[model samples]
Target: MQPTTPLFLQKFSSNAPESKELQRLTSFENVENKNRDTYLDMIRIFINRNHVYRRGHVEFIYSALKNMESFGVQKDLEVYKALIDVLPKGKFIPTNVFQAEFMHYPKQQQCVIDLLEQMEDNGVMPDYEMEDLLSNIFGNRGFPLRKYWRMMYWMPKFKNSSPWPVPSPLPDNIYELAKYAIQRISSVDVQSQITVYQTKEIESSIDDTWIVSAQAPSQKDLLKNHDLKEPVYVEGSFRIWVKDQLVNYFVLKRQPKQHIKTIKDDLDDVSNIRTPIFSFQKPIEKQVQVMQSVHEQEDGVILAVCATGTSTKDSLLSWIRHLEKDGNPVLSDALVVFTLRTGTREVATVNNVEQKQIESK
Candidate 1:
């Protein structure tokens, strides 16, 4: 059977309002003097005038409903029903304003729950969908669910077509059970490894009329001298494992280099020392070399890695971990380190390196 279009979508025409009309209607001040019915009509116009319900319109409607009392416009049950009916389909509604406005009154609290129930009853959202949304709102806010047990009861009813019956003698306190379920649903696993290495630069220092060679500084000396025109390598390897199996691994490295120059006493002296200008090509080339060697040793096994700041790295790691939780591939027992800044670098290890699995949620 063909599914029916959701009522929220059916109430509106596909044609969007002209830019001038939308601009005028969106200004809440323009309708401030109008009666409550006019405000409700404005909401209906905003919903029906657009082909797709814009988030702004939904937010505006929510804002108006929340501030109806302050605006000296008492909203009736009909108005609340209309607002619920016109809510944007398949989108998250910001609940802060609504929660603050309605939380003080028991009747208003029931009204908000009723509106959500109506949306589910009208086929706008499935049972599980509504539960997920409500769970986020209630669970995150630490709202007591004793009065909203009906909502909690609705959670176990929909099991994605499982033939198994609901557990008999369900926990006496279903709210606690629901909270646990929500936590499990929302939890995630993250696996990360950070490797830091010290590097040194081998170069020559110039003096007046003389080219003097300087011995390469040790790692300790390079770290101590921040003004040195040398680079230090910080490499991080992140692997996300779910359900006790490795799904993804990421490799990243960064080198910080700086150069300093001194104005020679005699510009005419070609041998005079000049400030060093650092180049990143060496570090990049060395990283590429290490990657190539690792790939060759592993027979072209490739792990996805991105280079960015710590925030982006964390976001990607979290996103990949949350995507899927079941996989079969075991993490390989190989460790690769690219220490281009220092000589005698160990590029790859086949069996020498130990493999550890990390799970984050």
Candidate 2:
């Protein structure tokens, strides 16, 4: 380095005491700024991560809080709420961040009520996972009667540790609060609400009625195969019904064995053939596995088709059980088909079986 020559240069150099102090201060400011940025980055990352992945990192919030020690506690709590607000429910449970935040500052319970009320007015429902998290925060002591009422009246049945008490003579303030909460929850996820509503509609329309049976052809050949043959027919019939409608009634007794394979292969395509029909998950698999036994005994696959009702599954199982109990031949060679809204049962089964959840689009 060149030797310091000018008077001003010497004053501003690192060797100067004032210059050294300024450098230290700058370094501290840079470190502080970096720490803040790190916390913000962590919050964004945690919120944006997939639900399944986030479940594995369940301690993310605790880790983040520990790391962000520089921020004020109150501000930290607000950040936590923001993060929770954006989280999706998957295999993991949702938290009632409203209650959790209130726990840290009991005075903020009103604030939680205000937020919940606001959400309800907007027509958004919180992700399902939020339930337990909220319970953990509010427990039995904090949430008032109004909060319990909103949860009971609006939210669908889900697991909760404590029994919710019925609120009688629900106050005017509580009514307003309930209204607000419903709107707000609906706004959080309109699509989820729509899906739930549509599912219920389908459920109500179908109810618990359904039937499963084998299909048969109209006529049979009396002559032997060696003789001049007449039109041949099989005796058994394959069909299912709900509300006595022939939505997915397919019967083929004298039909070629290849018909079973044909239908199975085209299940995805024929799925939309019938109106108001719902395909259960893995339709092909359901047909093959459920009808395997019937096929062995009769050299033909039995088909089960649901006509109308949410009880197609139960009905199919009942049909199988009835066959076993009555000494009737089990038709493992059968395929089950359901007629309902397009993809309703299939999607429901997928969500119910696999714990998949809706993500914000």
Candidate 3:
């Protein structure tokens, strides 16, 4: 009924070539997909180029810094600062990530510290989390955390600030990282200068002071060794109560004497045991005492004489290795033996140690 259409036009219309519908189809599917791919590629490029968020990227930066060290410390520091600028804060990353990326080698850690110290000296305050992260990383070796914490305590900075955030669950790889790091740190004889600020408003109203008795040697004889019987007084507005004698003895043992040969030639090398005892409240005081006890009782040698759980045994061996790294001959010597505990045992004899080792094997 209609006028006859041209053959070419008829075929084009029937096949939907270059028609409104065909145009719509192309716009909806192919064009959209291509745009999405373009955006995704761009994002990938940004992340890869930044270098801080990615481990490989940061490691490469570290490598470059190491190679540049011969040029100058300032040059290396600049590289580190430039790299740190890209990494955003508050991101959840495993502790091992930092160790792997930034601290795997000793030179890398030293470079980072130098860079951070430089930044700090430049009057540009860094992100608090960065400082906390570094302190946690380098602190155990006794280099900076104690000093940093004490300094922070006195200064207006970090007073109103929230407590440093540590990851709730530690990652698995950090065990080996921490093991080696702790061992390396143990080798240095480090001391921290703690400046505590105390107010009378905080102490409990209760006046209960517990007196702990000594067993063999009485208080008078022990008094010659920085008398534990006397209440340890401090510059701060707080009273110290020596609740446990054993714990007090352990702590006081480290204090330097005038005539007796000191563990460290300088008197300043020793920590002020009086500070923790005088400043802390009850529960924290107890914790400090326990730490003191552990510090005192930890002998250099560990023998795998008895069969314990695999994890426990491995931990002991690791501790022994750490002691060896610290230059403790007792841990290194083959003469030191591990002994199983017996009923009413005072000290485990060398024979007992050998017998126990054989039985465990």
**Model 3 — TM-score against the truth?**
0.18
Q: Is candidate 1 or candidate 3 better by lDDT?
A: 1
> Between 1 and 2, whose lDDT is larger?
1
| Runs with alpha carbons beyond 4 Å of true place in candidate 3 | 1-104, 132-361
lDDT of each: 0.36, 0.34, 0.31
Candidate 1 C-alpha lDDT tens digits along 1-361: 9976455435444454456656566556765566676667666666665555454544555566555554444424445445545544433333576654355334323545655454344223233443444444344332323323554466446534443223432344433233233222222212212111111110121111111101112221222332223222223334332222232223322233322344334447769444447543332122111122121122222222322222222232222222112120111122334332223343332223332332321
Q: Count steric clashes of candidate 2.
A: 61
Clashing pairs in 3: none
- The candidate with the higher TM-score, 1 or 2, is 1
Candidate 1 clash total?
6
lDDT of 2 by residue, 1-361 (tens): 9764444234444344333533333232234554554455445544444343334233444444344445432233345455444333232222566644455334334445554554444323454444454554444445532474566566555323223222322344432333223333223222212111112223223234433232211111111111212111222223322111222322222222322442344545755554346644443343443232232224433222112123243333343333323322322222222222333321122112221233322
Question: Which candidate gets the maximum TM-score versus the true structure?
Answer: 1
Give the range of the ten consecutive residues with the poorest summed lDDT in model 3: 243-252
- Each candidate: RMSD to true structure? 25.6, 25.9, 25.8
Candidate 1's displacement at residue 85, Å, is 2.2
Query: TM-score of each candidate?
Result: 0.23, 0.18, 0.18
lDDT of 3 by residue, 215-246 (tens): 11221122223333322110101122111101
Which number leads on lDDT?
Answer: 1
Candidate 1 — which residues are off by over 4 angstroms? Answer: 1-13, 90-361
